[model samples]
Target: MAFKEGFVWGTATASYQIEGAVHEGGRGESVWDEFCRMKGKITDGDNGDFACDSYHRYSEDVQLMKQIGIKAYRFSISWSRILPNGTGEINMEGVNYYNNLINELIENGIEPYVTLFHWDYPMELQYKGGWLNSESPYWFENYAAICSRLFSDRVKYWVTSNESQCYIGFGYGTGWHAPGLELPINQVVRAWHHNLKGLGLAAKAIRQNAKGEVKVGLVSCGEVGIPASDSEADLQAARNVLFDRERSEDSIDFGFGDLFEPAIKGEYPKSLIPYLPKGWQEDMKDICVPLDYIGINVYIGSIVEACEDKKYRNLKLPVGIGKTSMEWSFKPETLYWVTRFISERYNLPVYITENGMANNDWVSTDGKINDTQREDYMNQYLSALSKSIDDGADVRGYFYWSLLDNFEWAYGYAKRFGLVYVDYSNYSRKLKQSALRYKRIIETNGEILI
Candidate 1:
């Protein structure tokens, strides 16, 4: 069956990943700028200094989206670009840059879904303890208010933040991302709590200062636990694993429940209540705000089965299973199971905010990039997503992980996850074979999938 009518088909990109000219726009330094400077931190010593040069060529990028027939475009705003020091005076040039981008998308009939934060925290703010500071929520709220007042007239959809688990767990717990710091579990939880508080306050600020009607949501990413079989025991086990909280002080199991529960359910999981900060109960008032929808970024999942010793265990994939260039498992069923579980638990309309695979793509002798792997990958995953919708999940939209081949964070520019291939040599754009197929899918509102 085809996806439901009015389902949104789109592509996503982040500020730091796509927008270069980081210094030319009066943009203040971000934690990522500093992280890339650390010895051996990034692959090939590659940084986003000239990533796709989207800051100067966004109009051309918009044309590419228009040609691809996408209905929406999900992109993040660089916080440092707007408030150079993360807070204080506004940077009008950054504001104008986004205003132009938004107008360009609308002029071409593409909806803009703005994500307020996507881990590009200002370096100035990082020096002030970043999310560890108790006043961090207010800081985020102020930034959100500025965004709402400036762009809400044209942009109707807003996301408070994208993937808190990564920014907290990977950034602090593992020191893998920006503002790298290998903090202990207790501190990580503290930062996570403040992040959630920021999500709530940002949501409130957006709605309060919005120029018109707006829909606010948060984008979260985590491991999905799919059942091995349709049996009741297996299903229960998968659900248990998906929602399980950290069981001990040393455990770093940052699952969907940790971030989602507080924002949507208004309380921490029972197992996590003891580890919460002293004023957490009072913080709940700001932590739990009503959201218009929930956005999930799914790339892979593991099969879960019931066990005698524990509620559930994730079974390792076979040695030769299909995998992405990033080595992530190629489990198409991840979309189905993740969308179904999230909808049933939260009872909110869901959006596949980010879903795509990375491939080692290059221009062939035919002068075109034939990324058949990504094309097949999208077919399998979208088919599973359609099945989830038919099974009564409120799956509303799907956005490919990226719109252009950009700087892939810690991996640097080595990994490519874009439907539109970009030649780094001279910053040229070419739509891959999969992009053409995606254009057809969008033109047919996914009827081509059937």
Candidate 2:
């Protein structure tokens, strides 16, 4: 089945990942900027100092989106760029850069979906106890207010935060991402609450101030449980793995559920209740803001089987299964099961806000990027998404993970996940075969999936 009418088709990117002018336009430093300077943090010692140079070349990027025939574009804003100190003092130059980018998208017949925070926490905030501070939620509300008041004229879709599980879990729990600090679970739990509270407050603020029917949500990336077979026991096993009471491991799904349950169900999962900080229960009132939709960033799934005592057990992945450049599992059907599970579980409209595979790509000898693997990956995953929608899941939209190849967090420029390949040598972007096929998919409202 084709996607429903008015279903959005677009591409997504993060400010710190794509916009490279870290020092330009009076922008304050971000944790990523500092994290990159620390020895042995990044894979290739690469940073976003000049990532795709999109800060100065967004017009070309927007033109690329227009040419691709997508109806919307989802991109994030750098907190430090708008508020240099992460709290006080507005940087008009930094503000102007985003304004120009937003206006460019609007002028090109494309709608803009703005994500207020995308893991680029201002360095000033990090120094001020970051999310561990009790006042962090209010600080984030202030930031959200500024963004809503400034850009709501054109951006109707507002994402309060993007993938808190990564920014909080990887940054705080395992110390893999920016501001790399392996804090204890207690501290990590504190940071997690702060993010949800901030997102809820931001949603409330955007609803109050945004012009012309704004939709607000949060973005999360986590585990997807796909049943091993089509039996009832297998389906139950998938659910048990996805939503059961196991609390031993600090998995991505745990973080995603802890952060998501409050917003959707007005409480954290039962397994995680013991870990909540004092007064965390009361804070749910602020964290349970009504969201327009839930955005999930899914890349792969884990196979699960029914176990004794009505439990589920994850089976280890066999060796030599297809993998991406990032070594992530290549299970395109993840889109189907995850979407179906989340929509039915949460009873909310779902959006695949980030979905794409990194490929080993470059400009070929004929001056063409013939990335057929990426094109195939997109096709298979999107077809899986369509299957979920066909099964009565309220899957609303799908935003390809990226529009251009840029700095990929700790891996830096080593992993390419964009439909448009960027020549780091000159910062020139060339569209791959995937981009053209994606354009056709969007133009057909995903009837191509049929």
* Strongest candidate by lDDT: 1
Q: What is the number of backbone collisions in each predicted candidate, taken in the order shown?
A: 0, 0
Clashing pairs in 2: none
Tens digit of per-residue lDDT, candidate 2, span 1-450 = 467899989889999999999999999999999999999999889999999999988999999988899788999999999998899999999889989998989988898999999999999999988898889999999999889888898888899999888888899888899889888777787888887888888899887887667889888777777899999998987866556535654543354566677887897877766666898888888999988888999886889888786577788988889998888898988888888888888888888899998999977899888888888888889898888888988988889989998899998899999988899999998888899999989888878753
Q: How close is candidate 2 to the true structure, as a TM-score?
A: 0.96
Give the lowest summed-lDDT range of ten residues in model 1.
244-253
**Which parts of model 2 have CA positions greater than 4 angstroms off?**
249-255
> All candidates' lDDT scores?
0.91, 0.86
Tens-digit lDDT string for candidate 1 (172-286): 8888898889988778888989999999999999999999999999888888889999999999888876676326676666778788888898868777776677888899999
Per TM-score, the best of the predicted structures is 1
